[model samples]
Target: MLGIFVLAPILIGTIAYIIRDTWAKPLLFLFQFSYVAFAFSQFLSVKANGPIIWNTGGYTDGLALSLFADSLSIFMVLMTSFIYLAFLIFAVNADYFHSKFYFMFLVLEGLIMGLFLSSDLFNIFVFSEVSTVVVSILIMLNKEKQAIYDGMIYFFVNVIGSSFLLFGAGMIYRTFGLLDIRAVSAAMPMLEEPQAMILPYAMMIVTVSNKTAVMPLFSWLPKAHGTPSAPPVISAVLSGLYIKSGVYLFIRFNQMFAPVIDMQSFFFWVGFFTSVMGVIMALGQRDIKLFLAYSTVSQVGLIVVGLSMGSNVAYWGAVYHIFNHALFKSTLFLTSGLIEKEYKTRNIHEIRGLFRRMPWVGAATAFAVLGITGAPFFNGSISKYMIANGTKDAGITLLLNIINLGTILSYVKYSAMLFGKSREEQPGKPERIAAATAFVLGVISLFTGLFGEFLTEFFFGIELQVDTAEYIKKSLVYVFMLVAGVAFYKGLLKRDRILERIGTTELTFNGIITVMTGYFITILVFLSSVL
Candidate 1:
């Protein structure tokens, strides 16, 4: 059954590609929906019966290939399914939905599912590499000159990352005589020389950090996510779902190596710096897609910080934020694509009067902006509050607030497109299905916050106690930040020369690789010192 979840999509997508008919898309969509339903049922069964472990060779010993689905993996599977479903629905109206595009997209989706479900370290590496190739093809589908360059950069960087991952997996296999993550984790405590594991840990984590778009290794993200040639749905999936695969691996490997090394503090600080730098870069972007892309970098940083905080509440908050970010950010990207399609421009400064011209898209965009900026009664606010509540230090709490302020300020510039006089008119009516999908996502973003406590408990079996007084206090803080963000944008950011330079500047392919190398070495040194 676990194999079915991973293999069914690949098979169906391949068949669809072979058919190459006009009806291939609808047929593919039906197959995908059926697979998602089956996967959800499996998820529920796992939830009721506990983890399901499948040994493909039917061997009970360590030599067999293993796939395991626990609460966490199944949850991710469900999230991936829903996001892909939304993307598919939007793609129904897209012009680029050819047989080859769906083929690569489904292949990528299946590989990601395999990544989440596979318990073997080698399997994870294999899945990661295959997904990287498929995603690069999708990135370069339009064959634009800049897109080709961005796609090559993305491809080579990930190829390097995957090679590191494979090396790390080989080390673990040699050390433990087993490649299964569960088996290795069980054996971790038995090792007499835990220090021997440090090099493997560093290699694997540095690679995962690059995947998660951590600072210094994040240069590929904005390029890939904001590539004008890629479809909006592709951008949404890349930002919302693809990146979380890296974060999932980070969490998995960190826990797997907990007996040998604990570097939560290092990751927590890295996440803080990433969040700060991400938003700073976001504040300088004039292109709407690039702005959202950098915001994703910042949000991923916040998620990392929450997970590394050593508090269960904060950890769960980070998990919830992952889901919330997918909802809001995907909506923002999809809606931005619609706006760009209508106006034939990507510049935020040139586009105007979305509210008057396309009210539904405008409303959805507004909700997404509010959700992302941590507005009171929005989904981001709840997750941010939970993460903040987990912090013991005043200084860290203040830093969290500053990150929130930065988020608000960046969106203040973004929200400009929602209002003002129109510069051009759209030619045709918008696609109803796409508009409806975005609006539904926007509604989910709002309702997720309104019912945060119940949903958190339902999803993760973690009870959250809401403090009304604290909520009120945080609301006031949000209001203050809202006012302050507006002032900062109007008075300072609008006139800042340095920010413009930082935003407009991008690293070359070699520069990105250099940063990744530097980050890997830094991690090695830091871990050596701490351990």
Candidate 2:
């Protein structure tokens, strides 16, 4: 089941390449939908926590490709399957892209599935690198020079990271004489591990951090996602579902090294700073896609904190939030794309009277905004509350509070752009394409709200007990935060002083100061603890 689920996209992609026509699109869509069905079937039949691994060549123990289906992998597979479906459907309305769009996208989809399912260390690295490359190729579908530039940067960064990962794998193999994840875990305790052996770990961290767009390493993300030719929903998936995979690997690797290092303080503060940094960047963007792209960086910081906090509840909450982010963010980006299709703009400043002409898109944007901002009765609200509760238990209340403040401020900026009065009134009929897309997304968002608890239980292997009282309390907190953030945005963002700081391009000296200061502070604290 796991191998089929992972390999289906590759097979489909190959077929699509051999037979490119109108039929190819529907075929790709079918394969995506089939994967979704396979996931649900597996969920019904498989045990909650047990892993099923399929190894080729008659199940040889030493050297064969293996795919593992666990709850975590299944959850990601299911999420991507649905998202790809939406991406393809939404893409149908666009102009002719390269034939390789279908091929590369499906192959990338397969690679992600394989990455999620792989139980082998080297294989995980292999599949991850492949997926990264495929994504770069997909970006080239736009044929923009910026796409090529960003793609090259992405390629270099991932290659460097992969080298570190390979070195790390080599070190682990030398120490334990094993390459499989399960075997390595079982053998890790007895290995003669040097503290400096973590250089590979550090490199791998840098690699995944860049991929996931953590604050300092995230300069490429806005450029890549803000590209005009890429589908907005695809951008959303890049931000929402795909980035979480790196975080997932980080968490998985962290567990292996738990005995040697404690990352609680480090991750808490890293997440805190990254969260604040991301939302601040988000606030200054005039383009809607760029704003959402920065918002993803911020939300990712929160997910990282949740994973690093390491409480069972926190871990599961983070995973739940991954699912929610994928759905709502993609929906929001798709809505933005639909608006751009109709109005031919993503500039928030020029995107006035959208509610008058494209009310459904506006409304869908409203729901998605509400969802990501953690409003009550939506999927984002539940996971965020869970994350907050989990963080409190993990002694990260202060960091979480700062993130909350930043998130509220970011969303307030977004909403103000939408609801603000238009400078010019233009009356026009609603676009069916925009309306249809928005309606679908709005329904999905509402569905997510109603069955939020069910999703958590199904995806995370935890029972969600609905607490009406807690929900009410959290609702009030959200309301208050929203109000406070709006006030701050109006008072501070409207001011020339703060706006100048936000809009100004920092120079080489400033960039160096930031990186050195942040990196030094991080290492100093770690060294202090060790000494």
Candidate 3:
């Protein structure tokens, strides 16, 4: 069953391509729905039973190619399968919803599922490399000049990053003579010196960090996700879901190294700095896609912080945040596409009167904004509240607030487009399928938040009791931050010369590579010093 989850999509996608778009349409609709059902059933099975492990080629557990579905990974598989269905629904009426596009899209889904489920290290590398190729193709699917350039940068940079994973996986294999992650993790404790693992850890993390879009290694994210020519669904998937794969792997790798290595403190601080940098960059973006892209960087940073906080509650909080981020961020990106079409522009300032011109789009976008800003009774608030409860340190709590404030401030600029007199008339109700899909996602964002406590338990099997008084207190803080955000945006941030200049600042490809190299070395040095 676990192997089928990974392979069926790839097979079906190929069949869809061979049969062409005319037949492919219904085929995909049926397959995608079934895929979601299958994934959900698997999720229930994993919840009822413990972990499920399948070793392919009929080999032994640690010796054969393996697929391991634990509570964590099963949830990821379910999320990807379900969300891809939403993306498919969003794309059904789109111009690019042809045979070729669906082929790549479903193929990408299969590879991502592979990444989530595979227990073999080499298989993970293969999946990562293939997915990078698939994503580059999607980025340049239109073949526009700028799209081509962006895709080329994405392809080459990610390939280089993937190389680090290959090296790391090889080292692990060489060390333990086992390719399965579970096997190596069990073997790690037997090593006399953990120092031998440092080089491998550094190599693999550089790749994961790059994929997660952390500081110094995040320049490529905007180029790929914020590309002007890519389809909105592409951007949504890349930002909302694909990025979380890295976070998933980071958790896995950390667990694998838990016996011999622990560097949560260092990464916690790195995540903090990355969050701040992402905020500064996001605040400067004029393009909605770029702004959302940068905000993803910030949110991912915050998730990393939660993960690295060395608390069980915070780890689960970060995990929950991944799901919430996937919901709200995907909605934002999908709605942005509608906003762009209606306004005939992507400029944040040029677009106006979202609520007035297109109520559904505007409302949906607003819901997402509320969630992303951690407004009370939203999914983001629930996840963030969990993260906050993970620590008792006043300074850490204050820093988390600072990050949330930055989020609010950037979205203040985003929300400006939601209201004001419209310069152009709205289209025939914002393309019903697109509008409806995004609106539902936005609704889900709110719905999840309203029942976040129950949903987290249902999904993660962890009952994290929330403190009502503290949550009420936090809600008050959110209200204050929202007001402050608006005041700051009105008082000083609008059309500021410094901010405009900052928005325009971008690193070249060479510069990104250099930063990545430096990041890799820093991880190596930091781990060496700490361990």
Q: Write the per-residue lDDT of candidate 2 for residues 228-261, one digit (tens) a residue.
A: 6776655766776677788777776776666565
lDDT, candidate 3, equals: 0.91
Ranking by TM-score: 3, 1, 2
lDDT string for model 3 (398-512, tens) is 9999999999999999999988878866433678999999999999999999999899899987797878998899999999999999999999998687876887788998998
Candidate 1 global CA lDDT score: 0.89
Number of colliding residue pairs in model 2: 0
How do these models rank on lDDT, best leading? 3, 1, 2
lDDT of 1 by residue, 4-106 (tens): 8788888888999999987798788898788779878987888788988889878984568888899888888988898889889888867898888888898
Kindly give the stretch of ten consecutive residues in candidate 2 with the minimal lDDT sum. 503-512
TM-score of each: 0.98, 0.91, 0.99
Q: Which ten residues in a row have the lowest lDDT in candidate 3?
A: 421-430
Pitting candidate 1 against candidate 2, the one with the higher lDDT is 1
Candidate No. with top TM-score: 3
